[model samples]
Target: MIFWAIFGYLLGSVPFGLVITRALGLGDLRQIGSGNIGATNVLRTGNKGAALATLLLDSGKGAIAVLLARHFGGETAAEMAGAAAFLGHCFPIWLRFKGGKGVATFLGTLIALCWPVGLIACATWAVTAAVTRISSLSALLAAALAPAFAWGLGRPDIAAAAAFMAVLIVIRHHANIRRLLAGTEPRIGRK
Candidate 1:
């Protein structure tokens, strides 16, 4: 169990977004808009390919870790592994405890537990992003709706998992929330 948790964390902490961005001559993603190592910030570089890769890779890490845990440690282990992966992405040791907001990681975990829920969450993100053109807003709203969606689907465990992920995401976005309330939050594709 401990080994799985550690492995999940390490895997999650890989920071593929930073790596890919740097490798593509885009410099460090963390130095860009929002200064976050996430897909939204990666998009600030105007490198759509890099942003998409970051999104898919981050989500893939979460999904792969949970699936591995499920295969080797069963349901409970998988849940624990998912939680660990989310944490790893949020507070990666390699990034001096600063990491992404964990939205992609959350989606990955949801995918592992229930692909339908993951699909719904992804749709929520896409639609919200399209309508509002605010990535942070879209991510926050999608995460906030996840628990309710899980409950609606009659999955208490998944609901709990999503709730925890939502809380973590919200906490990570505390600064953004403040900016949002003050009408100072930057919109997507903007400085």
Candidate 2:
């Protein structure tokens, strides 16, 4: 379990947003909107391609960790790995432990843990984002719904993991939540 967690953390700590943006000479991603090392902030660079790559890579790290652990050590190891990956994305050591909110990693971990529940959460995020044009809101709603979705789908293990990640995501989004309540949160594609 510890080994899988360490493995997941190392993979998740790659900081793909910073990597992709810098690779494209877009300057330091940490200085961008939200100062977050995530796809949403990557999009602020006005490079959709870079943003998409960051999203895929961030999501891929979580998924890969879960899948690898599951294949080698079973469900418990997979769960530990997934949670560690999400934490790693949120507080990566390479970034002085200040990293992105774990939305993409959470989604990827959920998808690998249970596809049906994961699909439901993803669809919820898409629909919410489409209707509200608020990335943070979409993520919050999806993260909030994940545990319920997993419970409904009869995956308590997934529900537990989703619940844990949901709490972390909400904590990370404190500023976004305040801005949202103030009706001052930035919308998608505005940057």
Candidate 3:
């Protein structure tokens, strides 16, 4: 379990956003919007392709981490690995511990732990993003609601992990939250 959990962290710390953006000649993602290596910031680079790829790859890492751990250990290990992966995304050591907001990875971890919760969180994000056009708010809403969905769906293990991930994700968005409260947060499609 420990080995798998560590492996999950290593996998999650890949920094897909930075890799994709650099590979596509988009320059250093850390100097871009919000200085985050997530898909939302990747979109700020004016490259939807890179953003989408980042989102998929980032989320894929979380899902793959949890799934791989579960296969080798059990639900407990899966939950532990999921949380670790989320943390890895938020504070990847490779980037001098500066990393992403972990929204995509959070969704991926939730989905791997409990699909119903993941689907509901995704739906929540979609609706929020559609209505408000604010990506950070959408992500926050999804993160806040994921734990409840996990609990309601009888996945207490996942609920616990979701709770932990939710808190860290919200913390990662402190600047966005401030911008949101100040009515200065950027909307989707705007740089």
Candidate 4:
């Protein structure tokens, strides 16, 4: 389990958004939009294709981490791997502890660990984002409901981990939360 956890961390630590931008000569991703290494910020680069790729790659890393651990170490290891992956995405050593808000990676982990909870979370995010047009709010609501869904589905361990990840995600969005309260948060399609 420890080995899988470490492996997961390493896998999740890879900042795919940053990589994609740099590879495409888009300049430093940290200098753009929110300075975040997530798909949202990648969108600020004005390259929809890059943003989409970053989203898929970031989520894929999380899913692959859990799948790898499960294939080698069973369900318990997979659970641990999921948590580690989230942490890695949030505070990657390679990035000097700076990382994304965790929505994509969290969803990826949840889906890999438990598809039912993942599907429900996705649905929640879709509805929330569509109605509000605010990505951060949508992610927050989906994350908030993740633990409950896990618990209801008889996966207390996953519930606990999801709770932790959800809280971390909210914390990472502190600035956005303040803006939300001030009615200054930006919508998905706008700057």
lDDT by residue for model 3 over 1-191, one digit each (tens)?
Answer: 78877888888899999999999999999899778899998999999988999999999899999998889898888888888888889888898788888999999988898888998999999999999999999999999998898899898877888899999989988989999999999999887
TM-score of 4: 0.97
Candidate 4: segments with Cα more than 4 A from true spot = none
Candidate 2 TM-score to native: 0.99
lDDT of 3: 0.90
Q: What's the TM-score of each model vs. the native?
A: 0.96, 0.99, 0.98, 0.97
What overall lDDT goes with each candidate model?
Answer: 0.89, 0.93, 0.90, 0.91
Highest lDDT: give the candidate number. 2
Q: Give the range where candidate 2 is weakest over 10 consecutive residues by summed lDDT.
A: 182-191
Task: Write the residue-wise lDDT of candidate 4 on 1-191 in tens digits.
Answer: 78988998988899999999999999889898889999988988889899999888888888898998999999989988888888898898889989898889999999999999988998999999999999899999999999999999999988998999999999999999999999998888663
Query: What shift in Å separates residue 57 of candidate 4 from its native position after superposition?
Result: 0.9
- The collision pairs in model 4 are none
Residue 139, candidate 1: Cα error in Å is 1.0
lDDT of 1 by residue, 1-191 (tens): 89889988888887888999999999878888888998888888998889899999999889988999999999888888888888999999999988999999999889898888888998999999899887788889999999899899998898999999999999999998998899988888774
The alpha-carbon deviation from the true structure for residue 4 of candidate 4, after best TM-score superposition, in angstroms, is 0.9
lDDT of 2: 0.93
Candidate rank order under lDDT: 2, 4, 3, 1
